[model samples]
Target: MSDTVLDEWQIALKQKKTELEKCQKEHHVESCLKCEKLLNCEMRETYVKAVYDSMSKGKGGGFEF
Candidate 1:
C-alpha cells in the first residue's frame, strides 16, 4: 500500500478507538457494577482505562464496544 493509504488507515483506526472509548465510558457510568463499586475516583478511572484497552483489540470476537 502507498504511504498515504497507510496513513489514512491508521487515522481511521485511531478514530474508531476513540469512539469505542467514549462508548465504554458511557456504558460504565450507566451500568458497570465494578465501576459502581469503586471507592476511589482515581481507581475507577484506571479501571475504566484498563477495560477499554483490553476490549479495544476485539480479542474475544463478537464483542463490540
Candidate 2:
C-alpha cells in the first residue's frame, strides 16, 4: 500500500467522486450531461464543489489557470 497521506481536500474529493460515480452507474449514464436531473442534482453539485475545493485547497477565491 502507498504510504502517502492525503490532505483533507483530496480526501473529500475522493469521497465525492466515488459517490458521483456510483450515482452515475445506478442511473446507467456515462456522463452527467446525459442525465435528466443534471440541473438540480445535489450529488453533482456537491461533487462540483469538491472539485473546486480540491483545486483551491479550501481557499475561497477565484481560480487562476
lDDT of each: 0.51, 0.96
After superposition, the stretches of candidate 2 with alpha carbons farther than 4 Å from their true spots are: none
Candidate 2 residues 1-65, lDDT tens each? 99989999999999999999999999999999999999999999999999999998998798787
Using all chains and alpha carbons, the TM-scores for the candidates as numbered come to 0.36, 0.90
| Model 1: pairs clashing at backbone N, Cα or C within 3 Å | none
Which digits, one per residue and each the tens of the lDDT, describe model 1 over residues 1-65? 55554344345455655664565587566433446445545544554554554555424434454
| Model 2: pairs clashing at backbone N, Cα or C within 3 Å | none
